[model samples]
Target chain A: MTYFHSVKLHEDKCKGCTNCIKRCPTEAIRVRGGRAVIDDARCVDCGECIRVCPNRAKSVVTDSRALLKDRKFNACLVAPSFFGQFRSEVSLGRILASIKSLGFSHVLEVSRAADVVASALSKHLLGPNVRYPALSTSCPAVVRLVQVRFPDLIDHFVPFDAPMEIAAYAARQEIKLATGCSDDEIGVFFTTPCPAKVTAVHQPVGQGHSQLTGALSMAEVYADAFKFLPKVTHEEPVYGSARGLAWAVSGGEGTAIAKDDYLAVDGLQHVIALLEEVELGRLRSVKYIEGQACIGGCVGGVLAVGNPFIARLRIARMSQRLVSASLPALDLAPSALTLRQTLLPRPFLQLDANIEVALQKLNELEALVGQLPMLDCGACGAPHCRALAEDIVRGTASSTDCVFVLRKQVSSLAGELMDLAGKLPPAMGRG
Target chain B: MVEQAVLEVAYQVVGGDFSQAGDGASRLKRVLQQIGLAPALSRRIAVAAYEAELNIVIHAYSGVLKAKVSPVKVEVWAEDQGPGIPDVELAMKEGYSTAPDHVRALGFGAGMGLPNMRRNADELEIKTVLGEGTIVYMCFANRA
Candidate 1:
C-alpha cells in the first residue's frame, strides 16, 4: 500500500548531496542515481528536507491561488500561526478583511476550532478507554512518525481530528447555511504552515476523508494578503479566544488540556526523545501530551515567511490582547469531529514477511554491519553505516557502495594487477 | 523445553545506574521489531525485559541482560551478582520493594517490577540465594 506525501524533490535541481538524507527522521530519503528518492512508506512529510536543502531542491505540493478562480464558494481556514506573520499595527479585523479580499468569501479561524477541540479534551481524558499520556493527533507528521517508527505508542494518540479539519467542517456548514450551496460547491481550504498539514489535507490518518478540500502555503497567502491590505477598506470582525490563538506556539495546547499535568514538547528531536521514554512505559503519570513536529509550533513551519522567534512573539502578544480564555461556541456534530478510522502501524522496519527469512536477514544484517567501517559517513548515500547495512541485506544496496570499502577493494585489485604485471606463467616468467 | 535459539545478544547493565535503565530492553525491542514480531507481543516482551533490567540496575551490584530469539518465542535473562531476595514470594507481590529512599525519589522503586514482569511475560522464573545473587528468566511467545 502507498501513502501520499506533500514533500517532494526536484530531480533536476538535486546535486546528489547527502543533506536531505541525514535530516529525514525516518531515514526515508536515499541519494540514488544522482537524485533523492523518497520511500513513500517511510516519509511523514515533515518538510525537514525542504529546510536543509542548500540548493532548494526540495519543494512542497500545495494548492495554488488558482483554486480561488476554480471554486464557486471559497472558504479559507486560516491556521493560528498565520496571524503571527503580520505587524502589530495591523489589527485582526484588517487581517481578516485582507484575506477575504484575496478572493475568499469566508475566512474562518482554525484557532476557533482549536477552542472547540480543547473544550472536549478534558472530558475525553476522563473516558474509560483513554490511554495515559495521550499523544496529540493534531500534527500529521507526528502521527505518521508514530505509525512508522513507534507503533507501540499508537494507542497513546488522542483520537480526534485536527483543528484544521474541524475548522473546515464548520466552515462548510456555515457557508452552506448562509449561501444555500451544496457541499461540492463550497470548497473548504486551509492556509497551512507546514507540509504535514498539506499532506493531511490529502491523506489524513484519523479520518477517512479530511474536511479540508485543499491546502495553501502560509507564505503564498502572506504576499497576497499584504497586496490586498490597502485596498480592503471594511474591517470585518475576526474570531478566536486568547487561549485558542495561543495554539500557534508549543505548550499552548497543553495549557488548554490541563492546568499542570499535560506536557507539551516541540521540535522533532525532542519529540522523538520523549516518545522513546513514553514507549518504555515511562511518563505514565502525565495525562496529556502536546507534541508538535516543528519548533515553536506551527509558527516555525518551513513554508512560513516570518522568522519563528518574531512570529512566536507576535502570536504571544496578539493572544495577550484578546484576553479571553473562554471561546465562542461553534455548532458541530460529534461524529464529524471524532476520529472515524483506527490508526494502524506502519511496519517499515520489518525485514520480511516470513519469520525464518526475517531472522536470517537480521543475522545477515548484523554480520554485515560488523564488517563495515562504522564511520556513519553519508558518502554511501545512506544516512549512516547501519542504514546502508540494512539496505545491503534487503538487496537494495551493496557493501562496496561504502567509499572506504570501495577504496580497500580498489587497492587490493591494484596490488593484484601489479603482481600480475611483474610476473606471468612459467613460459613468460624472467629468470 | 527451551532449545538453543538461532540468535543471542547481551547488554551490560550497571547497578544503581538510572541513566542506563532501559538501554538493554530498547536494543532488544529493535531486534524483535525487525524480526517482524506482532506489535503487542513485542511490546509485552519489551515491558517484561525492561522491568527485569531495571530491577538489576536498581538493586544488583552489576548484571548482564541477555536475549535469545527463536521462531516461536523469545527468552530474556537477567543475571546479577548482588544481595539475593530474602523472600521471593513477597517480592512477587504488587507493592513490595526494598529500594532506598533516593531511588524512590527518582519515581522508580514502585515495587511493581516483579509483578509487571510476571504479568507481561508468558512464563517467568527466579533463582536467588540470600546474600549471594539473583537470576531472572522470562519467556514470551512471538504470536498473541
Candidate 2:
C-alpha cells in the first residue's frame, strides 16, 4: 500500500548519508543508489529522519505560509507547543493577535479541544471494556508506529479522536457561526510542530476524514511571529482553566486526565522501549501510557524553531499563571470525540503473504544473515546486516551488496584470473 | 523449498536471571511477527509465553522453551528442571504461588502465572512431579 507520508527526501539536498537509516525506529529508510529512499509503508512519519539528516534533505509537506494570506475565512488552530515558541513574557493574546494579522481572521486553541479530550478520557477510564493501561491517541506518529510495529497494542489505543481533529471541527463551526460563512468559505489550519500532524491531517488514521484544511509548520510561522511579536501588546486570553496548555510537554496529557497511575514515555526510541515492556505484559498496573514521538513532547517537534527544553519551560510557567477556572463544558457527544473507524494494522513487515512461504523465507534469511558480517554498518545501504538479508529475501537487494561479501567475491575472481593467466586459451597460445 | 510445513524454535532460559528473564519469549515473538502470524494469535501466545518463561525464571533451576508453528496452529512448550508443583490444581489458582519473598519483591510471583497462561492459550497442559520438574504445553489455533 502506498501510505501517505508528509515527510519526504529532497533529492538535490540529499547526500545519501547513512545517518537517517540508523536513526529510523521502523528501519523505513535505506540508502540506495547513493540516495536515501523511504519506504512509505514502513514510515510512521515521526520526522526522525528530518532531525537526523545533516544535509537538510528531509523536509515536510505543508501549506506554504502564503496560503494564510488569502481572503477566505482562514482560522488557525494553535497547538500548545506554539506558545512554547515565544518567550514566556509574550502574552498569549498578542500571540493570537499577531497570528490574526498574518491572515487568520480567527484563532482557536487546540488545547481547548485537548481539555475536552482530557475529560472524555477521564470518563473513558471509568467506563467498562476500557483497555487498561490505555495508550494516548493524541500523537499521530505514535499511533501510526503502533499500527505498523505493535499491532497487538491496537486495542490499547484510547478510542478518542485527537484534539487536532476536535479542534478543527470546532474551528469550522465557530468560524461559520461568527462570520456567517459557508463551509467551503472557511478554512481551518493547524500550526503544527511536526510532520506527523501534516500526515494526520491528510490521512487521518482513526477517522474517515479530517476537518483540517491544511497544516502550517511552526517554523514557517516563526518568522512572522518574530516580526509581529515585538509590536503586539500582551493579551493572553485568561479563560476556562488553560490547563490543556500543559499538553505541550511530555506526561502533561496523562497528568491532566488521570491524577496518578500513569506512565509517561517520550522520544521515539524511549517510546519503542516502553511499548516492548507493554508487549511483555509489564506495566499492566499502570492506568495509562502517555507516549510522545518527540523527546519533550510536541515542543520537540522537528518543525519547531525553539529549543524543546526552553519551549517546555515557557509552557510550564504559562500554565502555572493561568489560575484554575471552571472547565468549559464538552461541546459534543462521545460519537464526536471517539474514533469512527477501527485502525487496521499495517503488515508491511510480514515476510510473505503465505505463512509457509514466509517461514521458508525467514529460514533462508537467517542462513544468509549468518553468512554475512553481523556488523550493522550501513555500507550495504541497509540499516543493519539482518535488514539487508530481509531485503535480499524480498528480492530488493543482493548479498554481494555487502562490501565484505563483494570483496571476497572480487578476491576469488582475482585468484581465478591469476591461475588463468598461466593457461591461455589453447588456440591463443599466449604466455 | 523443503515443503516443511512446521517450524520450531527453541531457546534456553537461565534460572534467576531477572535481567534476561524475558529474552526467550521476546525472540519467539519476533519470529511469530516475521512469519506473519495473525496479530491476535501472536499477542495472546506472547503473553502466555512470557508468563511461562517468568515461571521458569522465578522457580526453576533452568528451562527450555520451544515453539512449533505450522500453517494452521502454533504450539509452545516450556520444560523446566525445578521443584515441581506440590498441588497442580492449587498452583493453577490465580492467587496461589510457591514463590519466595525475594521473587515476589521483584513482582515476579503474584501467583497469576499458570492462570494467565490458561486464560491466554486456547489449550493448556501441565505435567509436574513433586521434587522433580515441570513441563508446560500450550496450543493456539490459527484464525483467518
Candidate 3:
C-alpha cells in the first residue's frame, strides 16, 4: 500500500500548471495524462504541493464528525500551535472549553506529551553510544523523508516516540487508569496544524499502531474551539512554557533536548540538506539534529488557517506572561512503571535505518538515472533526478514519471528506436 | 546512422556554493523525468546523477558531466579535468577522499561519490589517467 495520509490532488481542480509538482520535495506529484497524479509511496505528505497549487487541487484528508459516531468517551489533545492561530483575547481555557463544546468528553493539552517526549529524549541523548546525533521524530513527514531519502542517517534519529505519539499514549493511559474505559470506548483526537501529524496518527512511526483515534485540523477546529471559549475558564496552567511552547516553532526541539551540541533545521529541503551534512560527516560533532519538514515549524503548515508569522506572534504573546521558567518539569512515570526502556517495534533500526535496501534500490536506480537529462526541473514530480530514480526503485512509480526526461530520452533515441517510434515510442517504451 | 552525441554540462566547484551545487543534479533530474521513467528509477538516476554532479562541483576542479541517453538505457559519464584520484579503490571506499581543505570545509568530499555512484547505478566504470582526467561511466537501464 502507498504510504501517505494527507496531500491529495483534486483531479478535477488541478490545472496541470506544474506549480504543485515543482514544490514537492519528493516530487510525488506529476502532470500525468493532462492532470496531476500523486505517487502515493513517493509523497512524504509535507504539504508543499498544497501550498503552491493555485487551482486548489491539492488537499488534506480530514476526520468527519462521523468519526465521533461510534466512540463512547472522546478526548481532544490540543496542540500548542492553536494558541497562536486564534485571538489572544480568547483565553486558552476558553479554547479548551470550545473544544469540549465540540462534543469531546475531555480536553488535554498535547504539550503534556511533549513533556514525556522531551524527558525520554533527554535520557536517551545522555546515554552511551551517543555515537550518532539524535534526530527529532515529532513530525511524521520529516520522519518519512528520513526513511525515504536519508536512510543512512536514520541512526541519528532518536528512536523515542514523537510528542504526538507519546501524547496519545499517555493521554490514553491516563484515561484508562482514571475512568476504566476500554481501549475502544475511549477515543483520542489530535488538533493538528500540519498533515504529517495526521498521517503519523494513521500510519504510526516507532511503534506499530498510534493511540490517536484520528486528527482534527487546527483550521477545522478553530471555529469550534473559539465558540466554546466563552463558557469555560482555563483553570489549571498547561504544562510546557514559552520555550516548550516555542517547540511549536522551528528549532524548538533543540530547546527541549538542549544538549549544547545540537543542530535544529526546518523546511523539508533545509532538513534534507542538514541530513546530507550529517551523512557526509560534516556535522559529526553535533549531538542532536532537530528537523521539521515544514518551515517555521508547525505554524508553517499548509493547512494552517493563517500565516505562520502571525500565528507565531499570537502564540508568543499569549504565552508571554507565563514565562519560560514556568514550563513543567520533565516528567517520566518512573522507569519502573515504563516498560524496560524498549523503543516501540523492538528493532526500530530496521524500519528505515538500514541502507541495504536503499543501497540496492540505489544501484537499480543508478542504471536508469544516467539516462535522465540533468534538468532537476521537478516536472516529473519526484523533486530532482535522483529522487525520481529512487522513486522508480521503490516501485511506487516509473522513470516516465518525469515528462521532460521521457521527452528527451524518446527524442534522443528516436533514430535507434525508429521501430517503435510508430507512436513516439510510448514515452517509457513499454512500462 | 547510429548517432553518437556526447552532451557535456560543465560546472564550477565554488568551495561553498551550497545553493547552486545541486543545480547540475536538479537539471539532470528534470531530464530523467522528461524521459518518462518511473519515479523510483527517476529518483535513483537523479540521486546518482546529483551525487556525481556534486562530486564534480564539490571536490574536483571545474569539470564536465556528459551523458548519452539511448533507447535501451542512459549512461552518465563525469570527467574531472583536475588532480586525478590517487587511489581508485580507496576513494571508492565508503569514507575516504583526497579533497582539499577548502572543499572539506564545505561538508562534502566524504569520499562517498564513487561508491555512491556504484550503489545508485546498474554498472559503474571509472578510469583515472593519474594527474590527468578521471572518467566515470554510469549506465541506467530503461525498462521500456
Candidate 4:
C-alpha cells in the first residue's frame, strides 16, 4: 500500500457526494458503503478532495499535540492571511501571542520570508534565456499538476523556493542560533490554511523531504487566537510592499513575474484549462504564468475560516497600513540568498526521478482503465473526468468504483417498494 | 469494402511544427480511454504511441494515427511519408532526436521517442526505408 501522510477523509461527516473521489489527481478516494474511502495506494496525497468537498468532510492528518507537548524549542511561522478571518479589532500580534501561550516558544511572521522570496524572484526572473517567462512555485498543487500534466513547461517554472519553504528554513536557522540548540532539536511548524502544505512536507519539491516539522491549519488556530487576543501584547508590524502583499490574490504572482507580461489563473479547473493552452504552445511568448489551484490564492484555501472576499479585504487594509516605505536593505549577509536557492529541492519532474515504479503502476492502470465504463459520472464519491479513470486502473478500486451504479440499484429497489405499496390493504382487497 | 476502422485521424506537418506534434497523440490517448480501454495499459500505450506519433508529426511532411479496438489490445498504426530514418539502429538510442530549436521550446525533439514507444507498447514494430516513408505498428494490450 502507498503511504499517505495526509488526505484524511472523515467518514461521519461525508455526505457521499463523491466530489472528492473525482477531483483527486491520483484517484485516491473511493465511495463504498455510503461513504468516501481513501485508498492509500493510488493517492499521492495531493488533497484535491479536501478543497472540493462542500460538506467539510475531507481533512488533513496534521501533526498531533503529542508532537508538540514536551518539545523544548518550538517556533510557529504564521501565514499573513490569518489576519482576515476574525474581526478587525483583534490585531495579528494578539493571535501570535495566543499561539505562543499554547506551548510555542516563539512566533515569527511568515511575511519576513516573503520579503526574501521577492528579492530572489527578481534576480532569477532577470536571468538570460528565460524567454518563456517564469511561473511561480508557491502553490504545491499547481506545481504538482505541472509535473504530471505539463512537463513541457517544466523549465518555465521559476527555479526558486516558495515563501513558505524559505520561511521554514529561516525560522529553523533562527531558532537554532538564538536558542543554542541543535537543528534537529528545534521544531518548526508552518501555520498553513490548506492541506497541500501538509503533503508538501513529506514529498517536497526540489527536495525529497521538507525541513518543516509539521503544519498547523489556520482554522485550527482561530479559536485559540480569538480567546487569547485580550491577554497578548502586539508587536511592531513587519514591512513589505503592496505588490508583495498582494501575493494573497489569484494573479499576484503574475504581477510579480512581470507587470506588463504574464498571466495569472485561479481555481483548479481554470488552471488546468490554461495549462492546456500553454502545453499547446498558444502562449509561447508569455514570460510568466502564475497558477493557483485555489480560487483566491492562499486566502481561499479549504482550511481557512470565513469567505475569501473578507480575507482579501483584510490583506488589502493591512498592506495599506504598513508604517515602513521600503524593505530593510540586506547588509551583505553572507549571500543567504544563494544558500537559500540551493536549499530548495530540484523539480521532481525529471525522468530520472522514479519512473520505474511509475511505469509499473502505469501498466496496471492502463489495463484497468480499459475495463471501466468511461462514464466519469462522479458517482463514486470522486469527481468525474480522468481522475476516476486513474482510480479504476489502480487495484485499490474497481468498475463499480462509480457510485452511480449503486444509486441505480437503490433506486430500482425503491421503485419496487412504491409499486408494492400501491396495492390496497389486505382487508380492503379481501372485501 | 468494409471501411475497417470507425475512427481515423490524420494530420499534415509543416516542417518545424515539432512542438505541436504531441497534440494528435494526446487526442488519441483520450479516444482510447473514451472507448473504455483500461487506464493503466492505456497510459503505457499512450506514452509509447504518443512518442511514435510525435516523431511522425514533427519530422515528417505528413502522417496518420490510425487505431482500432477489440475485446483485447488496441492496434495502432502511424504511417508517415517524410524523409525516413537512414539508420534504424542509431535512431533507437534513448537520447537520439532530430528536433530543432523551435521544437525544443515546446519540449519535444529530445531523442527519447523511439525508445519510449518501445517501452510503452506491449508489442512494437517499425519498418523504414531511407528516402521513403516509414510505418510504425504498435499494440497496447487490453487488460479489460
The TM-score leader among the candidates is: 1
Q: Considering only chain A, what is the TM-score of each predicted structure?
A: 0.96, 0.94, 0.79, 0.76
All candidates: DockQ: 0.61, 0.70, 0.06, 0.06
* CAPRI rating of model 2: medium
What TM-score, computed on C-alpha atoms, does each candidate reach?
Answer: 0.96, 0.94, 0.68, 0.64
**Residue-level error in angstroms, candidate 1, position A104:** 0.7
lDDT of 1 at A222: 91
Name the 10 consecutive residues with the lowest summed lDDT in model 1 chain A: A319-328
The regions of model 2 sitting more than 4 angstroms off are: A69-71, A233-240, A323-330, A416-431, B129-132
For model 2, how does the per-residue alpha-carbon lDDT over B10-75 read when each residue is reduced to its tens digit?
999988998998888888988899899888888888999999999999999999999998888899
C-alpha lDDT (0 to 100) for residue B118 of candidate 3: 89
Query: What is the C-alpha lDDT profile of model 4 across A1-431, one tens digit per residue?
Result: 23445777777899877677667654456677788887553454456677779998977877764567656888887776676676655555556667777778777776666666666666676778774656778888777666555544566776666777777777777787788888778778887777777777766744445778888877877777767767777553344455566777676655445566668888767887776555433455677778887788888887788798888887778776655643352222424433232222122222122333333344455555555556777665555535555555434356565555556678999999999998897678655
Candidate 1 stretches greater than 4 Å from native = A323-327, A418-424, A428-431, B1-5
TM-score-sorted candidate list, best first: 1, 2, 3, 4
Per-residue lDDT of candidate 1, residues A1-431 (tens digit): 76888988888899999998998888999989878999998999999999999999999999887877777899988888999999866777789889888888898888888888887787798888988989888888999899989998899888788888888889988988998989888778898899999999888875478877899988989999988898888877667577678888888786566566789889887888888788777788899988899998899999888998898888877876763333357877777678766898887899888887888888899898898899888988999999999999899999999999999999999999999898777786456
**Candidate 3, TM-score vs. the true structure?**
0.68
**Native-vs-model 3 lDDT?**
0.68
True contacts kept of each: 0.62, 0.68, 0.00, 0.00
Residue-by-residue lDDT tens digits, candidate 2, A55-86: 99989999876765554788888899998999
Alpha carbon lDDT of each predicted model: 0.87, 0.87, 0.68, 0.66
